[model samples]
Target chain A: MKLSELPFNTQAKIISVDKKIISRVAAMGVIPGTEVKIIRASPLGDPLELEIKNYNLSLRKQECKLIEVEKI
Target chain B: MSKNLALIGNPNVGKTAVFNELTGQTGHVANWPGVTVEKKTGKMDKEFDVIDLPGVYSLSPSAIDEMIARNFIVKDKPDLIVDILDATNLERNLYLAFLLKELEVPIIYVLNLMDVAKKRNIEVDVDKLAELLGAPVIPTVAIKGEGIDAVKTKIRKIFSDGKLAQKSSIPVKYSKEIEDKIQRTEELLKKDAPHFLSDKRRWAAIKLLEEDKEVIKEISASPNGIVVIENVKRFASGSEEFDLAGERYNIISEIIGQTYKRDKDMITTSDILDKIFLHKYFGIPIFFMIMWSMFEFTFRVSAPLGTLIELGLGALGDLITIAWPEDAWYTSLVLDGIIGGFGAVIGFVPLIFTMFLVLSFLEDSGYLSRAAFNMDRLMYKLGLHGRSFVSLILGFGCNIPAVMSCRAIESEEDRLTTILVNQNISCGARLPVYVLLGGFILGDGATGTIIFSLYFLGIVIAILMALFFKKVIFKGETAPFILELGDYRMPTVKYTGIHMWERGREFIKKAGLIIFTVVVLMWVLQSIGVDPDTGLLAWGTDPENSLLAGIGHLFQPLFAPLRWSWIAAVGIVFGFLAKEVVVAAFGLILAGEEEPEGLGKLVVGNLAVAGVAAAAMPALVYGYLVFVLLYTPCVAHLGAVYKETGSKKWTLVSATYGIAIGYILALIINLIGGVYF
Candidate 1:
């Protein structure tokens, strides 16, 4: 399933990220098999937050859709 | 021994505080030659020099900041790197540390914010971590200047003791497949690559494998080297499958397990605050309350000081008038031209300073990021990045810094669009015009709502324009929102005060001379004209027959559709210099009135002579207010646009677009208010 479809506050494991945004996202320490939890979405819900590697990183929904994830 | 050291780390790792401790207060900030990224360099105890690089997530060149960081390290080859890390965020922070370590520079690992980590029960074993990374480790709580002596002692030892053992002994080794290619690249680099990195074969190898643009371009200088790079590219290797970042993280996870410890169930204060601040339903209203209180506090609290300044300038003008009672040109020039015009703008210093203080406080406290996060969804819909929202909020204080603030934005198209629309976000300079016009013409009770509606209209128009620009001009995919919601920390009193003072001082410096020169010129124009009876150029003529009146009349027909008078048109024309002069224009040409109680009354008293009827003042001024809100920001702001964009064409676009939109919006307001009045 897509990371964008993950329920709020649920834990997930990254599968693969689309090649186009890989370099940008990879620098933030997001990569295949990294454990991530969707913390919350913004007020209007287009940009969302995730708890990854002991830090909170925010990403737009358009970006999240490019990452594949499986709920753990 | 004179040595060079570069300071680098991931964003929000207390890097600036660490730099302050290392260099004291002697740091000089400048741009990196051509780039807009600020480069901070300073001398360490007058013995060693330190260059502070921009914070980045990694060494890879995805963003302009990252590119600069990578280029600085590779090109300058500083003797040692002072790598600052957030001890509490050991895993994420170590990622960049490893990338820097690959540059083969001896590093002094400074674990900053140790006090916060101790409170959270995260203990980083300094010695063990130092042993693992093969560097001298010093634990520091930089804000208090704790543990800095040890870091400095180690730096001095490395310089005087002998040459550095630059490369890490226990480097994070790549996969076997990647290692083979690295070895092959090493041999090729030693033979064909520049002699600069030849001695540093291992680092050059990794950079080549990473396809670093600089490394490739340099290697392309040699014909044989170009073929070798092309060969490496054409013949694929299994090493390509290895995720370099993930591999580094995996090794860091190992190092973290051995060298760091924390309570498993510790939930920080930052997490708790994020819950309420990030709450969906209450979040937007809370954000608005904060903004409202900031503006209201600026208005109500700054009133006393603002009034004092007004009275002081007014008294000085009165004294000058007493000294030169004659109808000489210099007397009117000193009294009505220089004093009157400059005084009108200078009186708002208190309001501007107070606003800067509050804004600096907000930016330092880390709520600004949450504010950006909260506004992200709305901003993205408006055809702007979440970061643009921060710049627009800064625009409310002043647009010069607001336009400069767009450097944080990564995408070029998004940054440009934000810069273009920023002038519409009414700044502190424009506030004087609003209050004077709104209070006198619109009445006290409705003025509050009137001011609020004007601000709301600015945002509405900014968003629509951004959307239009996105769809019609400079179109591209949305700039991805990738922001670190860093740990919330208390803003130090010293830093916040400095930030506030510097910005407020900057505004005065930029505005002072421009306001003086333009006001003086306007006075001369308004004071001179042919005496209608004698048909000769003379001073203190009827302002209707003054030289200034000719300039105002030249543009009067352009604004005639709004039923605005030539005087109001003249105010808008002078506003192009600085918005505050709009009111000064009114005060000067108010039928030469003898110092009415205040500018508000002066504007009201001149309505009949301005060709604006008393009953029609509100509608005409409402249109005038809209024009001021959206028209070209002052000259200083346009200069900032040109500096930031580095394109004359874009600066012209930024200027012209505002006037076009201002006319259209103001006309809409006038036509609508024409029915209600």
Candidate 2:
């Protein structure tokens, strides 16, 4: 499911990363089992502020869809 | 000679903190060897020398910084190479390590931020990994002084071993067909060129197949050039060859998997902290507030010190005026020209240092990476790299280091874009101009508002300038920015203070060296005149008489369109030479009481007396400030542009474009206002 489709403040677990997200999501140390949290979403649902581990990482709308997530 | 060991790594990887721990002396910040790659090198415990090169990803050798790091490792050949790696992101870092191993130098990997790694439940056996690569690996938390001694001892052992070239036997994983193709390419390269290329030909061939420009450039320059490249590219399909190139990653991933296992963790400290900083409602406002506070603190907190320095310089000028009363020419030279020029600049040390202090704190705490992520959208629209904001922020302190920070940019076009527009950001030297103009227009109470507006104008101009330059000189789509948003960590006060002091010292040194000489020259020009009795008449006294007066009158027509008096014209021209020179020129030529106490009042009085309306002062002041903020950079910054871009054409283009835009903008303001007022 698209990350923007998730409800705000919902915690999600990343299941698999596809090749489309290689540029943005790949360098960020995002892999299977990495816990992700949606802290805030922009009004347009483009850049979503996320909490991954100890840091807040922002990903563009297109980059967010590459990570297939399972609701915890 | 103490054997120097430069600790090279990407920025925010705890390099400086590690340098401080190793050296035990305050580290000094300066340009890297040959270029303005902001480097920090110090004597380590009085025996070993540790130089910190600016952060870079690959030694592909496209930019000045990459060249500097590549040259240093290849030429200077430090006794031992300590490649510090962020443990959290080993994949990307290990890519560089593989390249470093090929340098044939003894390299010891320092896995920093191991504490952060432990939090993620990712575990690695350092010894096993070290054995696999034939290099020593030591886990360290540089901020906490952990494992430094062990790293240091290992470094000594590396020196003793005389840098025994460790032939890396770690094979890359490629398909059988690709491996056979690479073997053929390697044999051909070995036969064609044995001593010309440093890296293995197989690797070079692979890179060529991947369309790496740097590798292609080397091959084209070689004996069998075009044919060899055509053969390599023709052998492997583009996508297949590219996968083969990434074979290094496949091998590394399997190796890491063998030594490490990953698990799920509930929460990371970075996540908990981001809850507040990245809050949707509060994020943008909080960022603005923090920025506002930084500017406020820089000026207000440093005001007392700035005032004290101004007074001290004034007193010194007075003493010099009194000391050589008979040598009027020499005395005026010392008092009006030299001291006046430097005094005007020295007063800004506090603001300069404070800006550096704030940036250092943000950078050391790893908050700057987050800032890049936040400002990316705004910067992208401006035709610049997102990391350019970091350079622009650094420009607040000084333009020299700011230009150097352009190394973080990966694309040539974006790098040039950042360098060209960087000076639009108000530098410390321009602070006095801001303070004086802001005070003149808005009074002391509104000084903060005026100053803030000038700074904002700088940002706006930078964005516009980037758009203009890209459309004209550089025409291309900027390579999309891909950056790792590092987690925020608590900044170490010790390093922050030390870093701030280092920047402060550079400003003070520049003031002493450049300002002192300019002041002396100004004094000599005015003092040694035919009629020694009356002293040099301040410019515009007789219009036809006095060197400065004649020059100011000649330039008067040009500035008339900007609604400036001959005196203000002189001030603006001097400003182009050096922004602080504007204040000194006004103080010397226009503020006529031999020595004026309040510079802002002096400036106001001169303009008011010259038929420049009191109300027009604000418009004129804002207009003039805008011109300076967006105008041609001083000689030092231009020199930096030349060094960073390594092109005289770009340097000339940047300077000419800035001045043309500044002059046109200043003229537009006056033309509209003259008809109205």
Candidate 3:
């Protein structure tokens, strides 16, 4: 499923990221093998905060949709 | 031998904190450098020159900060690269450290935030990590000055030895295929560009494989460069960039597995706090509440201090009046021109410092990022990304820094739009005008509400203009928001004090330089009068016949819709010099009229004489307040916008847009109020 569709607080592994932002996403430590947890969605539920590599990152829902993740 | 050391790290890794601790110089060490977009250089014990570059996640330049960090390392080639790694998040931070390793400089790995890591039960085997990375790793709690001496001693040793000392000569190896590709590229570079191969051929090779445009451009300019690039591209499979990053992560994960240990089940303090702070419904309200309290705290705590400075300046002016001989040119110059004009601007210093202190606290505490996170949806609706909200909040303190801080926004269109709309946000300089007008119309009881409404109005107008610009002028796709939410930490007193003092010093400098000269020129213009009978220039005569009045009369019609008199017109025109000068202008013009009274009384009396009825006072005052709120920012801010955007067209657009919007808003307010009141 798209990473944005993952329920809050659920753990997932990033499978692949959209090519346009793949390098940026990978540089930020979100690669195919990294385990990520949706820590929290923003108040409006559009931007989702994810915990990856023991650090927190907030990404917009549209951008999050670009990342294909497998629910673990 | 070079003595330069560059501090490189990911965002929120306490890189600047370590720089400050080592150099004893505060270089805006906040949770993020994206907000403070400037490199700082300082001396380390008079031997090593420490340069703090902006934080970056990788060597690749996506944002301006990354571009700067990468450019400095490649171009400047500092002797020692102090790669700061957050001990708690070593796995991610080591990604950048690996990139720095490619730069082929002598690197000292500083594992900062050791205290926080320990508190969270995260431990690192310093020796093991050092062995793997082939550098010396020093664990530090920079805010408390731990491990700083070790860093300094290492630097001293490097200087004494005249060569870099390493624990090991290990190199990070990628997969066989990637390694083969890199070796081929390196061989080609060495053959075709032997001059450039001495220092960082490995880095250039890797970048070529990753297809870094800048690196490709540099290499393609050399002999056989195009042939080498074409050869490299043909050999690379799917995506070499992703492969390099994944391989780096593999190396980092292996090292971290051996050296790092953490209590995986324990929830961090940041996560616990984020539960309440980032709550879907409560987050935004909590953000507003914090902001409201900060504003209240700023005004309440600084009000007495502001009055104290005013009274002190007033007494100093009184002394000057008594000491100087009456009717001498120096008398007016010293008392009115120097003390009256500059003192008015300087009097706001205490308040400005208080606001800066609160802002610094927010920034250092890491709440500013959360505020941006909460406001992301709303900011998105306005066609600006979430990060622009940080610059907007900064606009309340000062617009010059706000405009400059737009560098943090990754997209060019969004940054420029933020800069253009930032001027509408009521800055600290405009607070005095609001206070005076609000107090005149609604008295002290409603001053808070009035001022709050004006600030709110400025924000609304700013957002509307941003949307309009996004749709019409600078049409483009808005960059997707991706922000790092850092850990919440208590702000160090020294850091906060230095930040507050830096801003206060800047404001004082402006008062002494720009405001001081502008006020003197204003005094001269007001002093020169034209005699009606012969049209001969007369000095220190009736202000009604002065050059300033004639100039005021020319612009008076523009403000006629808002019912502003000639003096008010003059005040608003000179306000372009500095917003604080608006109040000083009124004082100067009124002092020339008759016996000077309290500013509040003068404003009320002037409006009464202008035939402004009590019923229409609120609307007129509100309209004037909105005008001041939306008008063109001070000259310093305009200069900042020009410098930041590097386009005269954008600067002119910003100024003209502000004036047009302010006039239209005021006219609408007047027309609507005339019918109701």
Query: Which pairs in model 3 have colliding backbones?
Result: none
Q: What's the TM for model 2?
A: 0.83
CA lDDT scores, all candidates in order: 0.81, 0.69, 0.82
What shift in Å separates residue B499 of candidate 3 from its native position after superposition? 1.4
Top candidate (TM-score): 3
Poorest 10 consecutive residues by lDDT, candidate 1 chain B: B234-243
Q: Model 3 over residues B290-381: C-alpha lDDT tens digits?
A: 99999999999988988898899889877877887888988887776766666666667788789889988888889999999998998888
Tell me the lDDT of candidate 1.
Answer: 0.81
Runs in model 3 lying further than 4 Å from the true structure: B26-37, B165-170, B196-198, B321-323, B531-534, B592-597, B607-609, B675-677
Better of 2 and 3 by lDDT: 3
Per-model TM-score of chain A alone? 0.96, 0.80, 0.92
- Model 1, which residues run further than 4 Å from truth? B1-3, B162-172, B194-200, B234-242, B321-334, B524-550, B587-592, B607-611, B675-677
Q: Rank the candidates by lDDT, best first.
A: 3, 1, 2
DockQ of 1: 0.73
What's the true lDDT of residue B168 in model 2? Answer: 24
DockQ of each: 0.73, 0.19, 0.82
